[model samples]
Target: MVETGRIRVAKDKADLVKSLISTDGATGPFQTFADAIAFAAALGAKHNRRVPLGEISKREPSPIRLEYFASMGHDCVIKLLAITETKDIKILSLTEESEAKRNLIFEEYANGGLEILQNELRGAVDYSERILLMLCPEREQQEQQNEEFDLSKFLS
Candidate 1:
């Protein structure tokens, strides 16, 4: 794949992203900004929301370099989301134009996911706990579906 520049989050969601990241003494669910972005992008893709970003602030919450995602093993997530969105395998082509398009799609989905997270996390004192709570229902549902194995017929 071609080298791209920085990946940007929606300006409006910058504060939300900050709250999700765990710093020196902070206790957030994500260890890095890239982790939070990947989560938001996945969330957006799950909800089928692709919101375009608005005016970005000049300072704070700096844009993440493309290399960070690759180093974090999130490069595949970008390519996967891009291919899924466009329903075109050609998006995987190793070219600058293709890479740019993939990044654009990923950013929009991440922005949308951030919006969803912002609404879900509102009025929360502990972000980590709140995120866990958000995940509980799905976990519970999966547990409920996991029935114990039965081998009664084998006894015949």
Candidate 2:
């Protein structure tokens, strides 16, 4: 892990991060930019969307640090994403190159997820409620799927 370095958000999505984080008296759903990024990365991975950051998109106002991710226990998410993307556990090797690869995968997924969120949150009155509304359907569908796959009941 690159302990001393920062994790960056795409320049295009920086404003979106600000809108979603709770710092500076913002009423966003997440308490910190790292939280939002982790959520976005998961969202993007769920949708299988990974958008690489262009030269123009990787700029100033980089959000969280590598240490913050480890401290907050989000490093597991990074490792999971990296391993899933490469389909090899070796991607989790403790080396600078491996860490860079992990961060790149994370950043791209986050960018894609942020794009989805931007469209979803546009013109919303409250971000927290909007996020909850987004999650409800997914949970319902998952529950329905679970009920459909209850094979023990069928056996009985």
RMSD per model, one decimal: 3.2, 3.0
- For model 2, the stretches where C-alpha displacement exceeds 4 angstroms are 1-4, 55-60, 150-156
Best by TM-score: 2
lDDT of 1 by residue, 22-130 (tens): 8968788999989999989998998999987776534556778889998999888899999999999999898888888898898889999999899999998898888
Please give the distance, in angstroms, between residue 127's alpha carbon in candidate 2 and its true position after superposition: 0.7
lDDT of 2 by residue, 19-127 (tens): 8977777899997778889999999999999997664234434647778788888888888999999999989888788888898899889888988899999999799
Candidate-wise lDDT, in order: 0.85, 0.83
**Model 1 worst lDDT run, 10 consecutive residues:** 145-154
CA lDDT of 112 in candidate 2? 87
* lDDT accuracy of residue 134 in candidate 2: 95
Clashes of each: 0, 0
